[model samples]
Target: MRLTGPVLLVASLTLGLGCSAAQAAESGSSSPTPSTTVTIPPDTTDSGGLSPEEVQRQVARAEILRQQILATSDDMAAAMTKVEEAAKKANAALQAYSEASTEGRDAREKAKTQADIADALQERLDQARSELREWAVSAYTQGGPLAEQLGYLDALSKEASEASNPLQDLNYLTDNRIRSVDDIRQVAVAQKLASMNAEAELGKAEAAEAKAKKAKLKAQGFVQQQQSALDELRTAHAEHVTEAGPLAGLLLGTGDADAIAASERLTDALAASNVSIKDLRLTPCTDASGVFPNGQIPPSNLCPMVGSSDEFLVPDAAAAFNAMSKAYAKDSGQLLCVTDGYRSYAEQVAVKAARGPWAATPGTSEHGLGRAVDLCGGVQDYSAPAHLWLVQNAALFGWFHPDWAAQGGRLPEPWHWEYAG
Candidate 1:
């Protein structure tokens, strides 16, 4: 009855339906609806039971992804725009050619225009093909079937494969995998469809290119060149339909690869763990020790980290931190001294009262998120070996020292590090 979360989405990936059909199916069925369709719901909809802020955040994220994709593909995207221009020119040329073939009115001038447009189109087709081919080859060679890169035939093949089976090489599915599968499958499908359209366009362009060459040689049937150009333009329009959708926001490359991988891992970990916004809201900042006024702290979603810190952290973040700690000890033969971990609102208030503004504000404290930790021993010193090692290695595990907490930072606390998970 609740048409929220990943159900309708996964159904869409698995079934492939229009947004309206999917919604209709979701609203109609009480049983698990294996509906087809993944319409992007409004960013903020009371129907989905999500707050406006959550919708805004989702939209913001999509916007950021779109920007990143376009930023990386600026040159290629610009080249692709020429396809549209070429399509327009081809239409014009075809009209001129048609007029030339008409009963007789100095047809030479119109024929010349058609030939000229064909020449321009051939040049553009060559450039677009070359650019796309390069990017596709790079993605295929580097990522194999898993690469998300969009380019030429390689991008096509990968999109098709990924669209169908995103979990191909992975061993098992996490909660995130199950829930995210549909949302991502839709993206992959959109990409796959786009690639198919592009393939068709490329084929038409190649054919037109050949015809254009012949026209140049004989300069005879300008009328034939006009027909070929018209056909290519039609294909370009079809390709544009796919292009105007998902590919605009998706980028497949290694530049942000680590961040992407970490995000997936974190999502899985969050799903598998017993963590929820509600549970976090119920947790106290610290065990009551009467160290602060009223001993009451804002509730937080903090879970205990494994192996070392008894300090609580948000579930996945704690896991990442623990993993980092293990690797750190193996590399350096020492355990980090954790003098402090998750702090309640009350605890933050107490610490700040004692330390003044030198401490982060209570609600603003990273410790409140259960992702911040305070180290003791030599690790707290900016020049200490432990701190130096952490700076070099922690990012590998999705942990980082905040710029504000680093040496020469506004606060300059070398003892602090936060899990980015």
Candidate 2:
């Protein structure tokens, strides 16, 4: 019924989950889920006053609890991924909409310009036709040019009264009539060309207008898509908060006091969880109403550490440690082994029970808050190559050996390191 070392640590991380499952079992439910709303016990610390016996009972089911936590973590991670994808799509959609809208506006403007040109051309055509009509009317009212010339010639011949030759006068009048007709014919030709140009321009204008309308519709569709994506992102995030919060609370202690005690733990957990520090960021509670005893922060608040199933830390520290570990691995052909991170008050108690004086008092340890980690592999030995390498390179990643863990310090532990940031 008892597990040791990593198994025990892993199990301890899921104590809250195990308790919830136990409740569900009692209620005859085949599946159990953590409560979104955690009722703060009268004593937020002291592990909700769980007796040593009850704690052991939960520890007996550590593997099961660990699996449950992992499953929930995976689900939350998927939801988070969806949210990210949705956000990206939404951004792209918005960009498309902006471009489409701009194009639509330009198209409409061009259409208007073309239409105006067509209108101007039509006006010119109308004026040309009116001038031609006026000339015809004047000719008709004057008894027509040919008829008047004939009449004048007849009168001259009949009178026999000498003037210039009649044929010559008739010829001169004919020449004047031909010149006037030529002028009118030229105007009509020019008007016809203008009308053709105007009609083409109008066609172009209509096409442009149609294009503008299509672009506007497309832009609207994209905008709507972007809005829908935003809504999905919000929903996904809310679900993440609902499901992961309690799990994080169980992994690390919650409430203001535990938060203060485990401030580093919280930072590291947030980092590892991949939650934005600003969004799910935790500040130590100032009032009694908000204090959660050890292992009280929501799972949503803590991040899973790299290369660690049960371990969690703040984002920056987790990133740095992973980087450091990768660098170490590149040099040594093996990853830096991690044994523990982000201890809850309950886990702190268990560790104390198991390791006695070696463990910090419950609720007082950095492991409870998530900023510290205990290493394995050769790093545990001061003279080990891993330890020497860390001494030379770990500080580059904001991780360093504390004075207490130095060779000449109060309790030299080569494997114990804390995140500076």
Top candidate on lDDT is 2
Q: Where does candidate 1 clash, by residue pair? A: 12-37, 17-36, 17-37, 280-300, 280-301, 285-344
Q: Ten residues in a row with the worst lDDT in model 2?
A: 276-285
Worst 10 residues of 1 by lDDT: 273-282
**Per-prediction TM-score to the true structure, in the order listed:** 0.30, 0.34
lDDT of each: 0.48, 0.56
| TM accuracy, model 2 | 0.34
Candidate 1 deviant stretches above 4 angstroms: 1-301, 306-309
Candidate 1 lDDT over residue span 1-421, tens digit each: 2222332343244233233444774466456546554454554122233344543444455445444434434433444355334433433343333223221222333444445555555555556556555655764678523434232344346657454444432323234344444544554455455445555555555555554444333322332343344344445433332332222112111113332343233233222221111001122233432122222333344556544546776666666666666666665665666788788788889999999979887776767656678887688887878876665445444455666776787988888876543
lDDT of 2: 0.56
